[model samples]
Target: MTDTVLASWRDGTAKTAILDFVTRATRQGPDFVPAGDRIATFDNDGTLWVEQPLPPQFDFVFRHWAEEVKADPSLAGRQPYKALIEKDPSFLHGVATQDPQVIESLLKAFARSWAGSTPAEFDAQVREWLATVKQPKLGVLYQDLVYQPMLELFDLLKANGFRVFVCSGGGRDFMRVFAEETWGINKENIIGSAAEYTYTDGGMVRGEQLLGTLDLGPGKPEHIFARTGRLPVFAGGNADVDIEMLSAARFALLINHDDAEREFAYTAAAEASLAKAGELGWTVVSMKDDWSTLYRNREQ
Candidate 1:
């Protein structure tokens, strides 16, 4: 592990709490961690990076779809995806939640559109795209905008025998791309919402040949169970979609982005779920109040 000092945005209280958790957890020395029980899960989108306005992966796919529409012109009149390209905020918030079929259709289209490439090839594409892409609001590379405090926390926990995992609602393949390239974490340890794919002689295949339901919300816990068998000891997230997964953990933390100056201040369906966590004894960390820094500018 690296000798990195973890800082907190709050008045040192959150930092104290975290260090206490780490100390007590490792009090039994180097071999103290519970066998196969040193699991810590994190939500990727809002918790780890900027997700407001749109998720980075969605923005990437939408950019591709938008370019296609520009070529066809007629594609501007199509449903859902068209609305998405036009930057219809309501279309994403409402349709994605209220209309199940719409979400399924969009995801299927994304899978089909990006399929036919080997996992390695697709990962390379994502890495190249992230290197060149900049966030509209932050004026920084998407990868540069990762939360610094959280990154430090990841290292701190790892030093204390915890195996950190990103259990996100974003595309598993997309997250894996960034995780492997930027953090040096193994792809197999990172789990997220996914569309099914089939193995072919040449490479993995998608579309009709692929069969499975997309993972989301409650399905997160199910996927974790199927993959790891052991429940997580610690979990952190910033959305209602993560409630079930958080609830399944022994120690859960919620990152509330309340800093309007540093980051957008907005609320979502995740609030009620967070309230439930409060009642259930989960720790809630306010971004504005708990984090001293917003991002560790990769350019720096």
Candidate 2:
């Protein structure tokens, strides 16, 4: 293994854990996992990118919601729309985060926005948003704010014969739009919350409908099992919602967001999971201690 494998990662417990995992999981090691069984799953939001202040997808939803209220004056009386109109930060924050009802409402909005459209149409909407939208806090495109060290980890793991899968609580279709370009993982490998789609015009057009699964908490492992037919050898997540998924893996990682200057300082969302990591001997990657850099400039 060369130094460049994880150059962006600081020399610490997090980096050592990764190096040791790769070494032990490689062919020469006595504990080597078979290539076929070398499966790794990762949570998307806070684990892969900046989910502070708000989850990135919420930015997309907020805009869509605004347009909805504008087109229909009565929508202004609704809970989400009223909160948005009143600029209630706490209310917006809940909608942007792990709140179950808010998550469901956002999914309904997503369905309404994309239903009766082709896959191409949905992708185009996400593409346009990625191109046009910027994070309110950082003033950078959300796609461009992906953690650089994690991207390096992906390349390293793949080179070592590990098949990676993203098992995220974020909208499946929403993550699929940027997963390939950002993570270098194929869309089929992504396991996220999804809505049912109805075929139309001989399958050329599809309409999004009711959610198939929410993909949070215990649903993480359930969805992963239902989709992959195997439990992952490795898993990474950042919040309590991922506790079940992390617990189900042979090697688990909890990405602790504690870098106040470079990024966010957040442990409240994953406090229970953090305790679990300690009790179960799962590795917790510290954003402040493990990463030397949060993100890098993307090539246009």
Candidate 3:
């Protein structure tokens, strides 16, 4: 049954555990979860797609910032711009590790970049970026890099009456642009750090202030509960920032990017999460061993 359900997943303990959990959750037993409360949330970066080099959202924002620097040379003196100008690996490393101070700095600038733009305007900008920019190493559009195995898992969960949400620390508006087309999830189901909005001049416009929180660490479950009214029964993530969310779930699956041959492998950001997985007895999915394929074909 697991073989037919999770086609891109190899036979392994991770697969078996997932199948067992789902079966128990669906069956009428002590561990069974009610359908309405069957919620699964996953961290976007690393867990659902490639996040190396930089997260795709940062790549999008950085492109715009580069052009911003070109337009006004004075802005180049500031951080993010300064970091980009000098090609600072430490700044990039901070982002990869989801260092809070680093992310907060970026978000402040991000909010300023499109302060008063309407949703349609923001969406158009994202669409343009998606159409033009390709992942650095893969040479394919970023949207095409979503994992096929994760998508199959989504299908299996949905078939068994689970509501899945993609929760990320990246911009919610950015992900919503391609959520339906790329992840096959409704825009509302894509939860992330978001800017507040104001209704003015007969339209909704973005505000410089972030909505509530930056959606990292504790913010993940906070945002999930705020939006869904409950914590996830199942959750998946692959970095230190995800530990809180993973720990909150009944079944947690952590992805280990140990497949340098098919996909880039490094434990730079995932060390703590891996340790937590071991300590908590959370199921660990090895990219090299558990997944038969790394990505969906570009044509897909």
Candidate 4:
């Protein structure tokens, strides 16, 4: 199993550090983590998979909103929802400061548009989109663009007795869809931004009911606490939004995307986050300098 897993690494620090961490964490024996405490949390989007063009959940919500506005033209004139439909990134930029009412309204609108759909149905939709959706610049299927080293790291951690959970800003439902299809991760262990839903006599009804809070920035740590009840010993992510959650872990890693030739070469955000994380004593993994294989695909 080690040899088989090492074959995927191709001599990268991502693999090396992951293997070392797993061995060290597990070697402390069953006493340290125990059976139920072997928890490892990961950020989705930029951490586990490619979030370049746009986050998958964002695309889904946007597409859904576009269809709804197309059907009811009046919705196109609304404030937040209207801005979302118009592709105004600024609408969601400083979302932390937006009125709770505004956030609630937008979330409900999104839920109503996407609710009543079964989990299986939602999964199918995402899979279908991934099959056809191509990144604007890469021109490759979005699913094909996931980070290879990160995937290997996930497997390595799992093999060493860590129960991996995706603690992301993406919708929990959408993360479940991709996790099941791509990595075979259990749906129950996935935690992310979620809206309210109800199973009534009629059917499953999704409402604008805000479940808890958006899982990003400082909210990442909040979600981790709410969902896991205990701090994760190991955590991995790639952005400033993940710093809070990463800081909560005993072993924290930031996937620094600095290699433009193989993958993307943008690190301003990552570097800023790493500086803060360094102050907090977190390990920074440079994709360019540390990972020999940045992406799963070799040809593209």
- Most accurate candidate by lDDT: 3
Error of 1 at 190 (Å): 1.4
In candidate 2, the residue pairs with backbone N, CA or C atoms under 3 Å apart (3 or more residues apart, or in different chains) clash, namely: none
What lDDT score belongs to each candidate, Candidate 1 first?
0.73, 0.83, 0.91, 0.71
RMSD of 1: 3.3
Residue 112 error for model 4, in Å?
3.7
Candidate 1 lDDT at 210 equals 26
Instruction: Output the lDDT of residue 194, model 4.
Output: 77
Minimal lDDT window, size 10, model 1: 94-103
Q: TM-score for each prediction?
A: 0.87, 0.93, 0.97, 0.85
Give a tens-digit lDDT track for model 2, residues 207-282. Answer: 5565576888888899888988888888999998899999998889899888887777877668799899989999
Q: List all candidate RMSDs to the true structure.
A: 3.3, 2.2, 1.4, 3.5
> Between prediction 2 and prediction 3, which has the larger TM-score?
3
Residue-level error in angstroms, candidate 3, position 110: 0.5
Q: What ranking of all candidate models by lDDT puts the best one first?
A: 3, 2, 1, 4
Ranking by TM-score: 3, 2, 1, 4
Which candidate wins on TM-score? 3
Candidate 3 residue pairs that clash: none
lDDT of 3 by residue, 104-207 (tens): 88998999999989999999999999899999987888877889889999998999999999999988888889888877899999999999999999999999
lDDT of 4 by residue, 1-300 (tens): 457774545565555766666666666665355646777888987787666555656666677677777888998898556787676765564332222344455555666666666555766877787777677677777777777767777777777788888898767877777777676688888888776777877666556555787777777778877877877888988887787888888788887767677656665446667787678766777766666565676553
What local lDDT does model 1 show for residue 139?
A: 83
lDDT of 3: 0.91
Report the Cα lDDT for residue 6, model 3: 93
lDDT (tens digit, per residue) of candidate 1 on 223-282: 787778877877888777788888988778788778888887866757776688669977
